[model samples]
Structure formats: C-alpha cells, structure tokens
Target: MFRAKPTFVLLLITFIFGLIPWIKAHNSSLSFCNRTCASKHGSGGLTLPYPFGFSDGCEIKLNCSATGKATVGEFPIQFVNGDGIRVNIQRKCNRSLKTVAQLFGPNYAPTANNAILLNNCTEAAFPCEIPSILVQTHFSSVSCSDSNSTISCYSERNKRAFIDLERLKKERKCEYLLSSISAESLNTSEAPVSLAVEVVELGWWLEGQCRCDVNANCRELVSPHGRKAYRCNCTEGFEGDGYKAGSGCRKAFSKCNPAGYISGKCGGTTRIVMLVGGIVVAASLTISLGLIMCCISRRCLKWKMRRLTKRHLSEATGNLNIPIYSFKDVEKATNGFSDKYRLGTGAYGTVYAGKLNCDEWLAIKRIRYRDADSIEQVVNEIKLISTVSHPNLVRLLGCSIDYGEQILVYEFMPNGTLCQHLHRERGDGLSWLIRLTVAAETAQAIAYLHSAIKPPIYHRDIKSSNILLDQNFRSKVADFGLSRLGMVETSHISTAPQGTPGYLDPQYHQNFHLSDKSDVYSFGVVLVEIITGLKAVDFSRPQNEVNLAALATDRIGKGCLDEIIDPLIEPHRDAWTLWSVHRVAELAFRCLAFHRDMRPSMTEVAAELDQTRRSRSWGNSEDNTCTPSSEVCSSSSSSNVSERPLNFHKAELAGRRELLTFGEKSHVNLAQHILRD
Candidate 1:
C-alpha cells in the first residue's frame, strides 16, 4: 500500500467512523424488512397492511375474526391506507368515556379529522354541533335521556391530530362518549346523516425516531401524554410505506418514460417540449373546470335547499288553511323592516307592525337567526295555533318561508302585551278588572291547550309578555314557539327547561320533566306580575325580592298579601275588591307550589278565576260604593256567597282555612272572612 499524506489519513479515519453507524443501521433495517408478518384481508375487503398485521413481528397487532373483520381493540377497522387507518366505533346510549380511553395505543390515536361528542356531560364548554333531537333519536335509552345533561362536541383546527384524553377528562366532566364525526363529513349545514357508527381516522406511527427512506418525509408526533414518535410519508412522485424497514418509497409509474428522454428516443426534444406544454395546459384547464364546477354545485345546492324548504312549508300548512306570502311582499309590508315599523324584539325574533296588501294590519315576526331551530319553531307555532280554535289564542294569518327567511304573520293586537302595560307603560294602565279579565282569559287559553286536544299541547312558555291585548283589552296568548305536543299515555314529557328565568318551573328545571303543571307554574309568575305590577325578574329590586314570584310567595305565605299588592288597585279596595284580590292571590300561591302535583290544573285555575270575576260582578251590581268596614258590604255579600256552593276542592278548602288563620290578626282578616263565607 502507498503511504498517504497526513491530511488524507485523518479524513479517511473520520469517514470510516461515520460509515460504521450507517452500515449497522442499514443491516438492522434489512433484517426488519426481511422478517415475515403475513398480511390478511378484513371485512369489506379491506387490506391489513404491514406494521398492522394479525401475527407476530408486526408493530401493531390486529385482531382478525373468523368472519374477516379486523379490529385493534373495540373499534372495527373500516379501511387501511398508506398514511393511516379508518376505524368505526359504534355509538351506544351508555358507552362510557373510560371505554373510549382504551382506544389510544403506542402505535395509533385518533387524528384531528375527527370531532368527538361527549354525552351527558356536566360541563360542556365545547361547541355542540349535533342537534339534541338527533342525539335523542340515536341514544334513546333512559340513561341518555337526562334533559338537564349537556352534550359537547370537541374539535380543533390547525392543531395536533391526536386527542388529549386526560385534558378532556379534567376539563369536561363528560359521562359518556356519544359519537365521533369525521371532519370531512361535516358541512356548513352542521347536520350529519347518521350517528349510529362514528368513523374515526387513527394516524399510525412507529414508536421511535424517524427512519425514513431517501424519497420520504418524516413527521414527528407527540402523543396526548407527551411521548414522542414519528410517522413517514412518501414524497411527491413516490409510493409505498416510506419507512426503510417497510416497503419504503418507490417512484410512481407515469406515461412519460425517463429512459426514453435520456436516450433522445421517442421523438426527442420536440416531443418532450410538447408533452411538457400539454401537461401544463391540461392542468390549467382542469383547475379552471374544477372552479366552475364548484360554483355550479354551490348554486345548485342552494336552489335545492330553497325548493325543499318550499315543499316542506306547503306540506306543513296544506290543511291549516293559512296563506303563504312571498318574501318580497313581506319585506315591502314592513317597509323593509324599518326601525319605525319594528314593534318589539323578543328572545327568538323581532316583531314588526306590517300593513299587508289587503289593507290588513298584522304583526310580522321575523326570526332573528335563519337556522333549522328557528324554522322548526315557526312550523311548531303554525301547527299548534292552527289546530286550535280559541278566541283567547293568537291567530296565525300567514307565513313566508322564501329566500331563506322564516317570517310569521299574525293578527295584530293594537293594545300590545300585558307586560308592556304593567311594567313599561307602553299603553294606558290596566284597571284591576281588566287585569283580572286578562288573567282569566289567559287561563282559559292555556286550559284549552292542556285539556281540549286529544294529545294535549303544553304552552311551555307562559308569561305576561306572551299575553297580547286587543283593542277591547281582551287577552290572547301568543308566542307558542316553545310549545310541545304532549302524549296521552305519558304523565309528563321529558325535555329541557325552556322559558323566561323567573317563570321557569323550578321542578321542571331540576327534573327535566315537563307537564301541563309546568305551564301552570309559569302562569303563576304572570299572576304575580298582574297582582304586583312588577317585572317578573327585576334586578332593581332587593336581592331577595329579585324574583317577583318568590317575593309574592313569601308575602302571601306570611299572610302579608297587602304588602305585595299593586298600589294602583289599592284605591278601589272595597269589601269585594279585597276579597277577590286575596282569592286570586291564594290561587296564584297554589299555582306556584314547588311540587308539580300540588299545583292546580289549568282547567281548575280557569274555573276559579272565572268564579272570582263573577263574584266581583255580583258584588258590583249590588253596591259599588260599599266600603270594607261597612255592615252592608260585609253582611250582605257573606250571606249571598254562603247561599251558593262553590266547586272548591278539599285542598282549596284547607288552603282557605289556613289563609283565614294567617290573616286573623291583620286587615287581611276581613277579606279572608268574606272568602271563607
């Protein structure tokens, strides 16, 4: 051997040392690739790829059943691809979060392309994309029917693919894993086709640092627990596993031959130039075509949706005999929904005073949000109102479901709402007689909903604001957006509590059990408002008196009824006025009972209020000027009332006796004594 220079010898030694590790790595990779891990066919003809096989020597062992179904754990593998695998997890009503926790492994985890829905969660800070009705339909078991329980759907954009299970458990006190939806499957509508099987993408990776081939890319991954691993993907113009130990990357086949170009065969440079130009031209045309197709598809989708909405509206209102106005007409009627024409805004929509083409003044309600929920509410109100024939109920004149708008037209009430009269001074103040009449009429309307129909209907939202007053001060219950049809066989419908804060039934709020009594409870708050002329929920009041119902209940319970009575009615406190006021207060107190069973039915309540109004009429006819302390006012009414037997339940009789005892030491005693006789 020839003697080498000092610099050459030093470089040679350095190169040898670096080459030793590379040689060892190459041999190890060769041995790993040579090791046999036979692949198998799975259900739906899915292939079980290397690194995920049924036998030993595989990175991730799969369980292949006799029927050819492959599973990693509880999740069935739907398909396997070069980059990842798709698994299906069947959703169950009672599938626990702990069960889903087992889905994570050293080789695989759910990718960012999945959105998880947590059912019956205690804290649902995440966005809820799934409709509650759809969830109810899929998970109908009693365990999943807790209306008070919340459902949360979790997803992140431009973040790590893996889900942090520990963070979810700590942050969201979720009880069950409802389902998972693919990110690709979701759309702008936010409505999925099915919830039965949740398809989740699990990105698989090898356990150590990346050992990718020359033509592959290495992607570093950190698990939910912060363990590091790496995945390999073949670079452009290549295919296969991308890992040196696996099949590794190989050049993808193409119509153009590299050898022919290098050898100057197959028509030489002119042919090569034409091929390149043709590819560029084809790609440009393809991109332009794709854009045009996308635009056409979007427009077609919108057209289809509009047509479907019109068809649905026609079918829904076919037998209701209500007209469907055009959106252009409705917009013109409200002067393009001008601020001056706007009557008032409520929780779900804004009402505008619109004059129709027929010279009809109507209240047009334009739902604030054009969403499925708002559309459903419009349909619900139309169906419920049209099914019943009651003078005390608001009349649905027509609706417009055009141009993606949900507009409801109703007969206008010139006098506005009872709440406006009582609290906001929108119109002339209501007298005690007018208030009582409104109360009785509202009761009749609600009673008709609860008892008149075969299946029965629940006016889930009952408040003074929903009680509209006409020209003659007659009350009509409006805004049936939250109403529900009750079943004849069931005692109560299980549903989430929905109503104004102060008017929501405490029992319904706690138990999620809705019944006719729930409406009664809300109406009781309205009763309190009528009696006190105070806002149902007023922050200006003292903390303990914030809720008018609570304050009225406390005062009435202590026999301090006069303290909470409306001052406007005080000047007219004759013997009959006092007695009738106390009686109505007593009725309201019963309606506000904490237990649903203790609350009176709407029918009973309507009858009692009617009788109280009749009693006041009888007293007025006899003598309008009699004072509370007058012998003529006291003796004559007592004798006349005692002669007629009232249809009072035993509970009412007992309640009356208790009231008499509580008021014996105060001025309320005279009213209680009159009520007792």
Candidate 2:
C-alpha cells in the first residue's frame, strides 16, 4: 500500500496537468467577461474600436457613414445592405459589420460615405430598417430580400437551433445605423474556470444581478462553438457566477508569504530561519569592507585640512599686519590717531591723524599692497605720481615701498569724502551752493586730466568716495590704483575686467577693452548715484528687476525725476537748478550709453558740466574756475587773432618737437583723430 502511495501521487499530478487547458479556458471567462473584451465591433476607447480595424478590411468604416464614405458627423449617411450594430471602439462611438459575408457584399462602397441600397429586399427577411441619412454623416439605409437563408451550427446534436427570419430582416435594415449584429452561424469562446461555483456567485456583479443567488447565484452562460448555454454558482474569492455547472473562478494562491496567505499554509520557524541567514551574510560583508576604508580616509583628511589652513592663514593675515608701534609713540599720536583724532578713509586708503617727527598733524594712509601685479607696478606708481603735478589731483607726499607693502602719504582733507556730503544724512554737511561747487570742482579736475595733462591719465575708477573734500570744500580727484595712462597713439588698451559691478562699463565688461570712454561711463554711474542717492548695486529687490540706470532713466522720462532725487537735495530744486541737474543727468545718460562711441569724450563731459555751472550762476567766485573760456574766446577771437603777430616759426619748431617726442605713439593719436578728429 505504501508503494501504491507514490503511484497515486503521480496519477494525481497527471490528472491536474490534463485539466489545465480546460481550467484556463474556463478561468478566462470568469475573469474577463464579454463586456470587458467585447468583439471587434464593440467600442474600446480612443479612436476607432479594434478587430473591425480602420480601413476597407472592417465591416464598417471607422469614422465613415453607414455606406462607408468620408463624411462629417452631422450629414446624410450612406447605408450598407446588411445587419449593422452600433458599438464603441477605441474611445469613439462607431458602427460595425457582424458577418464576414456582409462586409464583402455589393452594398459596401470602399469610397462611399455610407452604404447604398440593393434592389428587391423585403421587411420580413431583414426586420431591421436602415437608418435615414437625415443629418448624420456616416449612416445609410440598407435593402434586403425575403429569399435570404439563415445559417445555423451546433456542437450538441440534441440542441435545436432556428433562425428568426423577421428579426433578421429588420435587424439587417437597421444594421446600416447599428453597431454590432448577432448572426445564427457565429460561435462563442471562453477561458477556463478555476474556482468553486458557490464562491463565484458571491461577487458584486452576481449579488446585484441574481435575486435567487444571494448565497448561490447563477450567471448567464456564454457559448464555445455551439453547445447549449449553462450556469454555475461562484466559490470563495471568486467574483462572478460561472456559466457552466462545475467550472468557475477559483481563489488564486498567494505564494509571496505562505503564512500570511489568505489560504494559510506556513509557520514562524521558516521565517526565523530566513531572517538569521540574511543577517549573518550582510554583517560579515559590511565589517570587512568598512574597517579597511575607515583607516585609509582617517589619515587623509587630517593632512589635507592642515595644509589648506596654513595656506589660507598666510594669505589672509601674513602681509596685512600694522607696523610695530612703541607705546609712547602710539599714545602721542591718534592722541594716538584716536577716534576723535581720526580722518575718514577715502579711495586712496585709510586716513589717520598722526603726529610725525616734526610734531606736525598729518593724515597718514597706512597703505598695504592690495594687488601689485608685479614689483614693477610699485615702481611705476611711485615714478608716475612723483613726476606729474596737478593742482586738482591729490598730491602724493612720500612712499614707503618695503617688502610686499607700499604706502603713500598725502595731505589731510579734514571734511572727508564727497560721498558723505552728497549722500550722508543728519546735520553736518554742505548746502546746495557748496554741493554745486563740489560738483564743478570735480568736473574741472577730470577735464584737467583729460586735456591738460601730457599723454593724459584716465581715472578709470571714478566714484564719490574717490572724490575727497578739503577743508575749503574743494574737490580733489584721488585714488590712482586703477588708473592708466594712454599713449597719444593708443586710444584703447586691452585689460582684465575689474571694477565695482554696477558702475562697470558695459563695453569694458563685454570685451575687456579699456578706453577713456569707460571712465566716462563709470563717472556717469557715480553722477546718477549723487543725484538719486541710490546704491549702484542694490539687490534688495527682485532678481529680474535690477539695473539702476535703466530704472532712473525710466523715471526721468515719466517727468517723475523728483521722485528719485534725494530728499536732502529736494529743498534746493528750482526751475534753473532743475534744468542744470537734468542737463547733468542727460550728460550722464549719454556717458552711460552702451556703445562707447556714443559717449562724449571726457573733455566734452567736463565742458558740459562747466557750461551748466556757468549758465546757472553756480560757484562764480574767481577761484571757482567753472566759467567757460569759449564765450570769452569766441566773442573777441577773430579780430584779435588776426591783429596779433604770427609766431609761425615757433609753432613749427614746437610741432616738430612734439612729433619727435611722441614717436610710435603718434600713430595711436592718429587713430583717435580718425575716430574724433
């Protein structure tokens, strides 16, 4: 009997394997019903439905009329002579031909909008009448005859089948507009069943459909070939009642977690065995790999940080230390350059009140080397400033060039930088007249550099902080760190991009080519700042809306220039003063034009400022120097020049001397002449 046990198991396995195909076929029916996988004539989703296809192969055209022709939705529909049924295909609503013979019939027109009528047809043979075209685009009427024979087939011999002639005739006529048709000869197929019949009946669909099948429900039988339709009750976990007696949906076994399975069949011992096995494997791998890497990285980080820290500390604090001061010397000065004894820092460097060897009060700039591209630049600055002399330019007293440090001493300007008077609030400041005077002095200084100096020095970085106010409130142009001297022949020089961001010239920013016009642009930005009391680069607002120059220009155009003008300067506004200020703004705007060629020369800018000052009676003192010499020269110029004796020989000698001195640089001057001669 024990030997027979193994044979019994083999036989059982064979029986299950043999039933698989039948079970699958039965199960497919239980899972996906006719409604889920409707015939090709049935509508699916999207465009046209499946099976019928879209072109001539289908019984009905996808979007065509009943006659199967191209037509819009609302129109007279052509008809095909056959039973038709309306069905959803793809996502759109459509009609389809049920029979293969009907699709190939003469009533079907491949090019026509809908089907056309065939002669000699009766209502009894094809009960369905063809739909009238009315306004429908794809529908058509069909004609059928009474002599048509209905074909029927059955797998079971005992089951009698008969065709309804009257219904067929009516349906064929109506088929022109309908979607799907039931034919006598067609066969139905289904998938296998897996579960007990009683469980399938408890499904939601069966519970709703079967009043008698609350505990056990009946489902409609679907045919496979031509056997009689049959029904069966559903089993547990199955949703719908089965169509056949024994075949129905079966509960699928959950193999993922056997103990937690709905049909439970496992234990805690198996789970613990797997858990321990996984932990041992994971820990062994992790410990071996981690220990090896940890030792290597721990040594590397310490060495790297020590090297980086030493390098950075040297750069930050090594060269920036102040000179050693004896206690007595420090006490004597400041009253030791004390808080009260201090003068404010300007563009040149910090200004401190200190007592020198002669016990003289002087403002000392303890300059540290900012960036002396080369040791040669330190020599160049010392040589350049020592040789050049201009009344309006701040004078360099003495320099200490030691090690990597360079210091320049200058006479004190007690009142501080022009930025404070123009931009500072509170009581200690200049009035309107003094402000105008300062602006005039600053313009005169720039003009002197542009026209009077030999080979001309451009104060490339010009801003309010660089303009220092003396005790007399006179403007002195200071700070030569970013300054450059142009040879007479070279009008522009290539340079690295460097400057305050907002006040930087657009041309210089784009091309890194520096010219005198770039200075004009920076000055323009500063002038706007003076007038508006706004920062050149303010990012407190939104990211998209930057650019102070464009914003101010927009306000000026709107006749709301006063809205942007500093409140401190508001009380000084009058018709003539406003005109003069607007004139300056206009010049500044021109100076700030994107194209360097469009901006006025620094000489012209100075001339414009001088003209405005004179015309407005601003700073008219003898020393003001804001008056235009052109008016005086123009009125008496022609007769006086002709009357005076000519110095032609002297002029000739001077011109020759100048040419020889300029040498190759003369070509640079000629280039500028070609541009603006």
Candidate 3:
C-alpha cells in the first residue's frame, strides 16, 4: 500500500488541529449574520423582527402574554414595534427612563426623536430624564419646560451611544415608561391618545459589530419595505454561511474522486478520515476535560462561597458590633415576613416590625431584588449608619445577607412615618410647634452630614415619608438608600438624580450632578408638606396645583400663600404661631429655588430656623413688645395680610437674614451622634 508522504501528513495534521476550528467558527458567525433571529406571538399580536431578538442575542427579549401585554425580561410593556417598545403607563411607577434603557443593556440605544414620558413628573422641571447614551446633556431637548407636568425630550444624536449601565443607574433622573411608536406619531395633531408610551427607542445595532464578529463576512440587506437588515455571508474558499452551526466552511469538491488523494488532494477518503479522527480526538479530550472541570468547578464554587462569607463578615459586619443576623433569626423575628408584622412598603423594600429576644423592638427591611442597585443600597445604608449617630437619623442596628436575602434591621419607629401624621393616619396630627421642631431637627441632622463629617453626605431623598417618629413623636430622618457621599474637595458629585418624584431637585434632575444643595431642595419640599399637609406631587388637585412644590411656589409668588395651607394644619390666630408659620413658608420658598446656587446651604438653613425659634422665645419673654431687632410686626400691622405673605416675607427675610442669623451650633453637632439609638 502506498502511504501518504511525511510532508503531506504534517500538513493534514496541521489542518485538522488548527484550520477546522477556524472554519467552524467562521461558519457559526456567518450563520448568526445570515439568519434573522425574529419571532412573533400571533396570539398576543406581538411582532419581533430584526433588531428585536426573541432569544439571547437581543438586548431585551420581547415576551408577550395571551392578553397582548408584552414584557421585556420581567417588566410589563405595552407594545414592541420596528423602532422601539411602549411601556405600560400604570406599570411604570418608580421606574425611570434610565432604568428602562438599562433593561436593554448598553449596546442598545433610544433612537433620536424618541419620546420619553415620566411619572410623578408633574412637579419636576425639565428635561426630567436625560438619555445620557444619546447625549451627555440636554442642550437640544425639544419639549422640556420649567413647569410642564409631562415632558418629551427628543434625543440629541438621533441614536444612543454605549453607556455604562452601572454609572447610568447611579446618575439617571428620567422616569421611563414601556411603549414605542412610529416617528410620524411625533407630528400628530396631538400626543397619541389612550396609548401614550413611556418608552426609549433602542438603536438597531451595537457600536463595533452588527450582532456579529468584527471579522465575519457581512452585507447590509434591504428588506422589502426598504428597511436595512445586516446579514453575514461566506468568504472565498470557505463554504456554508460561515457559521459553525451551518456546518462551517469546507472544500467545494466534497464528492471528488479518491484518486485525487494520490496527488495529495485528499479527495473524499482523506477528507472523511480527517473529519473522523478530529471528532474522535475532540470527544476524548472533551470527556477528560469534563471530569476535571466538574471537580474544579465544585471546588472553586465552594472556595468562593467561603471566601465571600469571610469577606462580608469581616468587612460589612466588622468590629462595629452590628449583628449579622441569619435568615432563620430574621424569619423568626418577623414570623416569616408576614403581613401582620409588616409596617409598610416603599420604593426599594418592605418594612416589618420585629422584636428581639432581648425585647427591644426593631424594623426589618426585606428588599425586593438582589440586583446590584439594591445590594449597593444595602451596603451604602450599612456603611453610612455605622458612622456618626444623630437623634434625628434612624439607627441601623444590624443586617442579614443570607442566601441572597437582604435584610436590614433598624430601631422600630413606633409612632410611624411623618407622612402618617401629615395625611394618612391623621389622628390629632402634629402641632405647628412639633412640625417646626421636626423641621429644625431634620435640618440640623442634614447639616451635620453636610458640615460635620470630613466629606459630607447628601440624603438624596428628604421627604416626609422618610422621616419617622417614635412614641414620643420625635422626628428621625430614615432611609439612607438614596444617600450619596459629598466631596470636600469638589464642588459637586456627578451622579444619577434619585429621590421621590415630588421631592427630587429640579436642577439636579436636569443635570446629573449632586450637591448638599440638592438635600436642601428636598428638605424644602418636606417643609412645604409639613405646613400644607398635602402630598408633594398630587395629581387629584387641579392641573395647576397637581404639584405641591409648584403650587406652593406659585401661591407664594402671587402673594396668596394662606389659601393653599392645609386646613388640618391651620395655625392658631396668634402673632407667634402666625409669625413662625410665615417664616417657615419663606424658608421653604427659598429651598424650592430652581437653581442649586439659589438654595441656601443646609448649615445656613439650620442656623436661620434656630434663630426663628430663639426670636419667638425672646418675644414672648420680653413682654410681647416690638423691638428694633425682632421684626415680627412690620409696617403692615393688620392681623391678616391682604394677600399671601410668604413672597413679601421672603423679600424682607432675604435682606434681613444677617439679623436673623444664629451663631449657635446645631443639635446634631452637639450630640455624640449615634445613628442607631
């Protein structure tokens, strides 16, 4: 028998070892490019064509139910069309545009001329949600205005760039909805009726590749409707679609005579021999690799678990004495996250009242998801709570991270959230003095964070819902999930604007830069809530008054502040009560300023409030007489001012602030602040 020459054998071996995998890889890539990964749910009336993958390759898999309600991942969406998807309006609570884009991953983008609708944006000044991937700033936003209840921002670049999801989640401000529509809808006589979507239109392709390898042979295919579809093809000397699944590239003359092998052509026999040998070798190596991998995988997984447990225990729990409770202990404490023990549910998690073996009552927060955002929040709250304590700030006693279940333990606030006192429960409610004191203490606590710490902390969410009261009705600022660290060196920290819709800072929302001033803005809204006893962004009220912040600002501006004050919180018709109320109203007005620079620093706000308290005290003790320094009785001496006095009062207060400035330190500064007790 004539055997093959040594040189020919070497070449064949090299082809088997190296060239086969490449051909297979090229074929696999081509298959990806040639085939359109589109699917449709006929029952649900949902269409998933090119640019919308029904499986892994697509950024978001459009899943639809029988009822025609579409879902991207787990989020309920209204529709998915050629350009984009439309999110269901009712399902978009607490979810922002940035959050929606993130569901699709970084490579996808909202198309230019895409519309974004925000929930609870009635009071938010535009452009509420900036699509950072499309443009870094809102320079050319189309329909944003200072007081529009709803805003539409057309993408500046007509396409989204690859954005860092973690960074965007941290710094995004727009509340995103689930829906998409044709570009023509943008020019309709009116916004789409009945199906107004809060969706981001994602771009069709990624930056460097068209869902294919950079080296894959590619061609842009135009659909019958003139839409461009990118597909991959095979290159010269290669067969198949250049995709591994398509049986990858091979020689064309597969049926050539075996005699060709005598001339080193490897006709059909040599080809078959090479193929069989390659598979046999690969199968043997795969079996060996599988066994090794199984053992190594198990060992690595166990090692990683032990390492993570040690790290979390050593670092997160640390020497702070904060207990790291187990899942069983927490379960026993709350009786299995029962409704009977549940306190309430907020944006991130639910709270339940729990009692320790030591008989001390505490609140346990069981978060919704184990995503990075939620985990980061838990870590943030722990790191923050472990530090500087204050009477006005809630204490985080301990935490549990068992089996990915995140639980945070805090000293139970018995009286309930400040919101309950302001509106919901409203049993006798809080007095103006109590409300004033709460405001003062909250400010002092924030001031401590802003000035006392080397690098201050900004409590991004400073609403009434976050302020809790103990049995004695003392206020403590609760919920540090949205808190951010401030730098002493930099003027501001660029981050995603996060907070309750009604209380988010407008300027910060417009530009993803956070500062101590943002807290002052939210606190100002809280102040208004305290005085008015109304929701921050209520839509039930007349369109103009839907947003309490805007309503209060409008009323204060027009000199009619008394008309909008909550009847439940009607201040007694006494000089001091009226004076105190007026002063706080003016302070709130200043706090609600659109520009951060215009808002007073938390330190200044605490000092001024302290001065008001002192001034009121000095007046009653000094025989109720008007003194040169105390301007309680201005030229308009009538018991009732003709119109809203906050605006007029603000003008006078701004000029005379030097007189009202208190040189005293805040209570938070004086206390050996303990976040827990």
The lDDT per prediction is 0.73, 0.47, 0.62
Q: Compose the digit string of candidate 2's lDDT tens values, residues 55-118.
A: 4443233344444332213222222111222222111122322321232222121111112222
* TM-score list, all predictions: 0.54, 0.41, 0.57
- The collision pairs in model 1 are none
Model 1 over residues 496-515: C-alpha lDDT tens digits?
Answer: 45777678787775667778
Error of 3 at 215 (Å): 45
In model 3, the worst 10-residue window by lDDT is: 668-677
RMSD of each: 14.2, 30.6, 17.1
Full-model lDDT, candidate 1: 0.73
Estimate candidate 3's alpha-carbon lDDT, on a 0 to 1 scale: 0.62
Using lDDT as the measure, name the better of candidate 1 and candidate 2. Answer: 1
- Which of the predicted structures, 1 or 2, would earn the higher TM-score when compared with the native? 1
Residue 603, candidate 2: alpha-carbon lDDT? 76
- lDDT minimum window of 10 residues, candidate 2: 195-204
Sorted by lDDT (best first), the order is 1, 3, 2
RMSD of 3: 17.1
Q: Choose 2 or 3, whichever is better by lDDT.
A: 3
Q: Which candidate number maximizes lDDT?
A: 1
Give the true-structure RMSD of model 1: 14.2
